[model samples]
Target: MAERRPRREPRGLGWDGREFEVTVGPVAHGGHCVARHEGRVVFVRHSLPGERVVVRVTEDRHPGFCRADAVEVLEASPARVERPCPFSGPGKCGGCDWQHVDVAEQHRLKADVVREQLVRLGRLDAADPVVAGLVVEELPGGALRWRSRARFAVDRDGAPGLRRHRSHDVVVLPDCPITVEPAARAVLGRDWSGAGAVDVAVDSAGVVTTTRLDRRGRPTATRVLRPGADVPEEPAGRAERRAGGRDWEVEGTGFWQVHPAAADALVAAVGEFAQVRPGETVLDLYAGAGLFGGALAPAVGAEGRVVCVEADPGACAAADANLADLPQAEVWQGEVDAEGLGELLAELGSGPDVVVLDPPRAGAGRDVSRLLAGTGARAVVYVACDPASLGRDVAAFAEGGYRLAGVRGFDAFPMTQHVECVALLVSTAR
Candidate 1:
């Protein structure tokens, strides 16, 4: 018998610079809805589900699917709305994917993506009641004026803007409504030749800091513009945030949620899911700026202990200072994978009763899940920014005797495809 050979992918059909009328299908994971034209699958952006639209294929000759943007909405869905931002359309600012979609409808689509990923990638059956009806709750004012952070791409002309979808060409943005007060006003309608990109972080106090990066993405300058102050060309460090009844000092370039309400909402969700009690050991892995640490420490009480492990030295340093008030909380300034959870657990001299996993966009890999399972934590809360990654990790956790007990998604990121999820997992062996 002849050995079976690997199937070869079909050669892509050229459809670039072409226009076609197509009916949009259900929302896919990447903020685009699926559609087909002449037996070829096309990923249509700037379109809503069930909308009949004319799409201009921007990319073809790709291995699996072609990319296109809605050139015209011939028949719009009831969920469609005039995009609030003029920069959000075909070939325009790629920063926002669903500006054309209604805010409520956007949450529905995101929830659909979450459910789909859990079913498909996580190998959870649709018949499983737990995986069937996922809902994405919107943070207070999630739709507009919620983004506390935005990084503007700089073009050759020195204008700070967003890049066009699938292109490096920057779209000059004059105004963006989704961003909170000063950062939006400071960044939009600005030009800077000194940097390839600019990072704008607005703290909880509404203080704006802009970091100018050179063409190589190195920070050349940092400046702070207090609220009501004129937008400075350069920016400086540390913005203070009050969350979980404590102050958090996060650096300008440090990792924090983009939405203004994300910190509070996530902290609440994590706290509720963790169910940490007095005198219980808690672990916060990939602890950025110790946001979860702040909440866990108080919940665990002085008798209990909270350990935060973070890799970014700058963020770790900031975490050290942020968690200083809570003597029960300890910060480990090293990689979670490199330091190894086993070593940390041994050093701490006990297993955690509750664990919070907030890894990067890539998600905590299988090795991390295995280690987490070995930790013997009764409860684990996982915070994720990407559904696909979360779904993959969910399966990994399953393999390690952890079952997804509950999941809640939040529209922390409004206009973009990104969604935040807080999942509760319980150890089956326990």
Candidate 2:
């Protein structure tokens, strides 16, 4: 109890602009490669693994770690390629992450990220076949022009552009290479003097719809233009989409896959994993437009039951319409949290044979995953966009006695760090 030491103040302004040379380590989650500098971890963007580069610390708020950009490359990996988009670079448009990487290598890198997340966060064994043999399949469309739906931020002066990395500043662009030409043109081709942002989408029929939102993020105007038409046409109520051998109607710029080919690829993977039999009950949680429920309805037959639960009313309505022809399929609009899911399971009065969930980027949280696993469903098919979220949820499922069966990844969002994963978890008792 001798003399008390004076309180130490927190350090401020770390190596924010410090520059250093480092050998980049393996890629980590969130579109960055790991590197070390003086015992501090540096998350360097615009850099590939196993390369020597000079990194400029862009952010240094944390004491243990910092964020940087590879301003100069001393040694480049073979996977490095000339960045195709002029708007993309270390401090430019933050839309695409792997534009400088070769297309094939981009797929491989995504696969590596998926496996690493599962092993590191999910606590799965690295030697597990599902983790060891993972691969990111390339969609039909190449990396460019795959983005069919995008939101462009509008600056105060009314210029529309994508946001810079972790920044609110909009980088005005003539066109976004990753986005479909028509969709990009609809948003970037014109200026919205008063809008804060614009949402644009090109449907399967090539109808371009743009919705202008004010600074508060409220929709101010909506316009629809048919293909090859310069003038605005009557509002195209719901954009039409085709997936799983049928046409679907979704709200303009709604929750359909940004990549045109993603739906088909995901449907095939889900169907193959689900293998729903006749007279079985299936739950499609977070169902958007009843894509999976409607697709499985035919396989389940009239005796079987398919329930699609979604929180968004608009999406639920679209799901209802999409599944209208299939009497066996029904859409329920509600939250998919632990509490809501429990109520849903109780109302069903019977355990589902298979549970399919395509949660948002945040993934189905641990509570929801545990509750779903407790339902004793034979199979749980998880469609995840974020690897960290998937890993956390998978770990929660494991606690509920589910084992990792298999997983497949899709390069749905090429040129970007985002990768879509479809994983199958089966009960150990099964």
Candidate 3:
């Protein structure tokens, strides 16, 4: 007689049609692993792939895929560590996913995630170079205090907190471990957000500006002056302190790289690859506070123009204020899509010599890809946050007539499994 399969049982995370005994095990990655009744498909998260656990039904449906949240662990994995945060285990903050797993394992899992995205979403050949990942053991300068900007929601009492992952409900945080030091200090010390956005920036002078606030999804032409870094003459200090490349204040509400040193390293890498020439025109897409613009303007000289494409009015204003001294530098207050870019480029008449794109996590679409391909620019430097997106766009560039020249990586968020990459490409000859 054939061996009998285990009997099926109901669980927490939902299952629509596919029914099987939920087997939990510790997977090689951090999360739990669950085997479905079919035995062919395995669901993984907080359980090891081999260990057994009773999974809660989160969502059920499709033929092969079912969503579940694990509730009970009948068997345990050796790798499991008692999670440190009350917000992470059993309870849910939803902000962090890998806190329960060992820190080293988190890196491995994140690497796998990136690798899978590259193969699955990017559609890269299996033989392509395996991109490596870095883990941040601690935030440099200080792990918990490195973040320079913070975006806090205003509750009714005028206190600030973060919204839930999917919902608008405010999560009142008595303590936020991930936020940078100065910004966190400014946030907790006072009642800043009054139904509006609040930003606290400390300039290089060690003075704090708590008054300038930014409200958009990203900090556009605006500044949030908090009780930190005070600007002498607003953004004008950037010109005055050009020797040290003075720090312009960024309010806690707007967008700025959480990791400052790492961002500097990445931008420096882009600068090195761009090999910008004086008297040449350049374009910065998705320019944030003109980090590229600020860095490249002097290299391009007063004669060269650095056109910035920024959608946020606040950021545009900030860019304008930051680059005010450069007569050749200008800001186009519009999106970086095909038509917008085309119009913005049309104003230049001639094609750009150097095109730098620091797109968000999603990466640029085909229209922008095609324009860069056909623009006849000598070189294009792309700075990307997500590796999968970078690889996809790199492949797209090859299809569009740009030959991939070289690529480099920067371990921006150490201890965390995030990597920042800069890629250089030269427009191929017709």
Candidate 4:
């Protein structure tokens, strides 16, 4: 006999599916606007600030706050516009949060979120010049078709698409407007009946590569398509990317910036803030493909040293290969944890003069932040994809005597709530 499936217990007094009118308030982190109905707070998506909309509660697991989508707009903000992507909207594709917002307004909203997160979580004063003067700069590409790399979820029937908002259900799509046309077509145009998802990327050379992953999220196969080629060629072990005035070798579908221009912009920002001088030592933690280390190696010169640390062996190998010509730069494969970082620092014999860390979305934890700050590095340039994570880590660094000196925001992921930030922190003791 077949095993019986467990039944889900209903949530009592829940607001799920309940509809109510709300006046949207300020933009909040995580791609939503805050609004209050009665005494409960609602995080409404697909709506702009200062707009009156009828929101449908999609989730109400928490007693104090619930997640909602604005189903009907009674009064629209000037920033509201027709969504460029037909796949976007309430209960539709959850990939983009600001599709309904104007492109310029989208940048402002992201800047607001970054500032708010820093002030609230980093314990920074709102009046601080760095916090008050923050702005989200736009990338070269327009709002649409800027995603150089993307992952499309494959449903059981084999259609590839993105997941719905906070849901496991896949919304099948013919194309994703925000994704590069070549990438979107490469994955969505094909049916992966057995694969759980497909990751596709278009490199700077116009080469398209697709990786098929099983339901367990393990890579099953990888195929490459050169420009103007009808069929995919044998799997190319690495993809070529040009950034920071150099070419980089990265694993296909690796952690390169989704925005084509993001790497160069970040490199410039990091370099300006780090201001590494000759004979200085620099540490690039979570260094993928040695992008920052290799870029800064010339500035440090042969008398200086640059160490690129990464946890992933694949990325480490790529970094090593990328920096082989730069004698001043070396790639060290290790986790950037508190304990590991401590050991690495001890082996260096001297603290780094400049530290550039491009941590993942979760950011370097408090322990890592404190450990890095203890190094007495003159400058710590942090590249963060999540503002809240950056804010929390900044707070931790403060405890170790570092002060946030400067910060710049980038709209690397347009049409989405995600924003990339480059921050500079200097030792207060200096």
TM-score, prediction 3: 0.71
Q: Which of the two, 1 or 2, has more lDDT?
A: 2
**Each candidate's lDDT (Cα)?**
0.87, 0.93, 0.61, 0.95
Write candidate 1's Cα lDDT for 1-430 as tens digits.
Answer: 9999998755567678899899999999987999998887899999998999999988886667898999999999999888888778888788889998888998899999999999888878876767776789988875878888888888888888888887888888887778886887877777797679988888888788888889998988888888777645454568888776778899975688888778889999998899889999999999989999878888788899999999888899899998889999999987777347768878987788999999999999888888888888999999999999999989988888898888899999888899999999899997
**Number of residue pairs clashing in candidate 4, backbone atoms closer than 3 angstroms, sequence gap of 3 or more or interchain:** 0
Q: How close to the true structure is residue 6 of candidate 1, measured as C-alpha lDDT?
A: 94
| Number of the candidate with higher TM-score, 2 or 3 | 2
Candidate 3 lDDT, 259-298, residue by residue in tens:
6565566667788989999998899999877778777888
Model 4 C-alpha lDDT per residue in residues 169-243, reported as the tens digit of each score: 999999999999999989885789999999999999999999999999999999999999999988977999999
Question: In angstroms, how far off is 22's CA in candidate 2?
Answer: 0.7
**Each model's total of backbone clashes:** 5, 0, 64, 0
Task: Give the TM-scores of the predictions, in the order they appear.
Answer: 0.94, 0.97, 0.71, 0.97
Give me candidate 1's TM-score against the actual structure.
0.94
**Residue 251 of model 4: what lDDT?**
93
The most accurate candidate by lDDT is: 4
What is the TM-score of candidate 4? Answer: 0.97
